[model samples]
Target: MEALKQSNPGIVVVWKHKALVDDVYYSNMEVFERVFWTFGPCVEGFKHCMSVICIDGTHLYGKFKGTLLVATGVDANFQVFPLAFALVEGENISSWSWFLGCIRVHVTQRDGLCVISDRHAGIIAVMNDPNVGFTEPRAYHRFYVRHLASNLKTHVRRNDMRDMFKVAAYQRQERKLVADMSLIGQACTKAIQYIVQVPLPMWSLFHDVGRRYGICTTNFSETFNNVLKGARFLPIMSLVEFTFHRVNKYFTDRRELSQTRSEQGLAYSPKVTSIMEKNIAKARYHKVEAYNRRLHIYQVETKRGDRIGRKGGHRHTVNFQLRTCTCNKPRIFHLPCSHVLAVCVKYSISERPWVDRVLQSEAYANTYAPQFSQDRTILGATD
Candidate 1:
């Protein structure tokens, strides 16, 4: 620990120790109760990523049994960017609150942030506490739909019920969500009752503020937890060292990939390009019925089988001036959906302007531009 501090002076490493009484230490020798760490490079790089973050805790299996709490951010390209890590004695209200408080102060001090996590009682309580909870203007807390589905299984127990619940959660329009939930109510009234007990804005995408940025689950943080699965068995310092090297390699590789794509003169990241291509293909099936050039409003009509609604075909309202579509995909993703694409094609307007700047290659490169410095502790000090 001393060596690490000396090598990386910018890294924030916090340790909580028990109070000594009568100028004497305890005999048990468990001096440290909790530890939190956030590398300097990660702190700097997170500014380029989205304001949304996901947090989850995993059990450590080493000689010292404890919980590993991890918080991760999402980059413009939808890649997972690890932020901070903490080791606590257990997963409880106090532990989670302490960890969250540290993150709020050190990492995400900005307002209008969104946090995603499972519905753990501890996490929920901490996030809802008026004094400590991230609420209203500061931040919004969202529940992971996948975890909710798992809990719903105990009541519904049917694969179709799970599928319907997912459909309702992912719907960006309240009408569509109501329709799907009605279907669930028809099939299993109990499932609908259970889901409605919780606020729709907490889990449903339709009512969420624009901060979610298309992420509906805590799977990204879980994926990072899985990446460090084997490292949990090592000692605390060893685990930290392993994570440092692993994250360095991750940033290095992604930086190279982004540079290669930029050299190709790509406007957006590969994932965004692929999604745009698919949307363009779907756009061909829809035709623009009316275009008010002065108003920048368009009315598009879909063919019989290309519509998303229950009806055979439907008309959508697209206002390029406001960068929105009645279907709600454009407003949610900050990208032009198929309907908007069709309108843009009819007007001969380049879709590039409609694309969100965050999805572009430049943002992706900026996210990984910070370099992790080598620790002199690992390599002997230079003359």
Candidate 2:
């Protein structure tokens, strides 16, 4: 633990052990219970990433069997950005509570943060506990849509249940979501009932109000777990070392990549730029009518597009001042939607300035700006 702190400044590593009883064990003897750690670079990088966090647990196949808990965030490039990690005996209320507490204290203190995880009883209980401070107004807890779909499929005994749930989960527009839910109800009443039991805002994109940033699952954490597949088999110290090296490389590689992209004069990450390009192409099929010139609000009407198969005649309101569109794409994804793009094109306004900072190249570079002590390779240090 001392070595870790010495190598990485501002690193937070915690070790918890069972208290020894005077009658049972010696004063110096203690049993290890849990350990949590977050890299200094990762802690600093997460501030530039999305506010949403995805957490998951994986089993350890080593001699001292345990579970590995991972917390990851999504970068502007839509890649998994590892934030914190823990090795606990198992997934339980006590361990999960302690893990979450450590994350709040050491990793981030941002309010209105959104946390996504499986429907684990331990996580649900801890987040619901008022003392834990994971509830609304401080943080919002949501279940991964994939896990919810799996549970619904298991309970309903229907093969199509998962597909139906996914359609509803990915819907950005409220009317589209209603149509998808109606279809699910017609397909299986039990499935819709099972899904409705879970809060709409918890899983559905339409009700998420851009809190999820278009992420509907815990795949980010799961992907990081897969990267540490071999490390989980090692002992505690070995596992920690393995994770440290891998995460250092992850940050170094991404930082360099962002630097190269910035050198090419890219305003946004490739993922964000690609999405914007598609929206720009679609914008050609939309006609914009100015509604409030002072407020920069316009009503955008869509025309039939053969390439996108978009049905024409849908009207959407775009407010440039608020950076919102009635289609909800801009608010949900933090980028301009077709309607907003059309307004920008019609008025000869630049769309780059309207994109959220989280998706911009500058923010992406800032996310990976911190250098690990091991390499000391600096790439666009925003600090």
Candidate 3:
């Protein structure tokens, strides 16, 4: 946004997860089968920052046992952008769908792209999800190629209508599957009643790529998890919240760094400065048709002595609030030429105050901060 700040103006949030959590919630609660209030907006921030989203899960053996999965994305500069996290019962369609849905709701914008792990069921979950009912002619869902390969692996060894095998497959693939299935079974009929009835999409989001890459074999998420390896784990909520705040902080820092470099380039990097100069001179001031800054208005010069505009002279005018002398420079180059500067200097308009406020960097850094306790190690985690 700093690069094209005027072109696209909007705010974005980013989020991520800490260490893995398994069985964080009870299977009776629904997709997560766990206990906790849903904090989704934080997750959506991550997706908005990174066009690509990565998802994965691990079994938990702590106080509450369940599979903890997380979703993260990459920002414009290809840096990590936090998304959302979920506690589920192993990695499965329901768990994944729930995670995806959380993200869909959390991020505010409706037009950005998405990238997910190469997992078969994730593809299936989005296709088969009932909540994402066929209510519209244009339903948008996307996934990466790696997930299809994962789907193939699990499907390859499966047969039809064998409930036990289904449970066994879940168990075999994920050890905690036994605990999850048992937990769901305890819910009697309400839990399993509508599962199969859910409509799965006919085409996988990345179905075409699976043919070439093989089914069930992409570790983008798994590999990324390593980035958090050995890192101190925090509460699930804290982790998710941290993701969004952190992404914003990173971008704010990056923008500042870019600005520093740009200024340095303006003074020393002729090649870089030339490009910016050309854009300022040619793209902006080639012709004057209307007031570019003013949303509505007509531009005209008063007759001085008074001719409004003379053939051999420049067109001087006080159009809108900007004083554009017969010379055109301020609007075109985002910098005042000698003529306008002369007016400002004569009028004693403090350029220093306006410049600092217009290009302040402190707000960029103060975007958000981790809620640090006087005691850094003492964190209350939301499972």
Candidate No. with top lDDT: 2
TM-score of 1: 0.90
lDDT of each: 0.80, 0.84, 0.37
Model 2, position 307: C-alpha lDDT score: 61
In candidate 1, which residue pairs get closer than 3 Å at backbone N, Cα or C atoms, i.e. clash? Answer: none
Question: Model 1: residues >4 Å from true position, as ranges?
Answer: 1-9, 20-30, 304-312, 376-383
Tens-place lDDT digits, model 3, residues 252-353? 555565456545542312322343344333322222334443432223332223223533223344333543433333332223343333333334543332
Writing each residue's lDDT as its tens digit, candidate 2 over 1-383 gives: 11122323656677776645545765665677778888888999999999988989989984879999999999989999989989998999988998888888788889899999988999999998878767887888877888898899899998788988898899988888999999999989888888888889889988988888888876788788877879878988778778878998898889998888888899999898889898888889898899999999999999986766667999999988888888888888888898988988889989986788888888899999987675322111111
Order of the predicted models by TM-score, top scorer first: 2, 1, 3
Error of 3 at 137 (Å): 7.9
Error of 3 at 226 (Å): 2.2
TM-score of 3: 0.38
Candidate 1, position 132, lDDT: 71
Give the Å shift of residue 362 in candidate 1. Answer: 1.2
How displaced is residue 228 in candidate 3, in Å?
Answer: 2.6
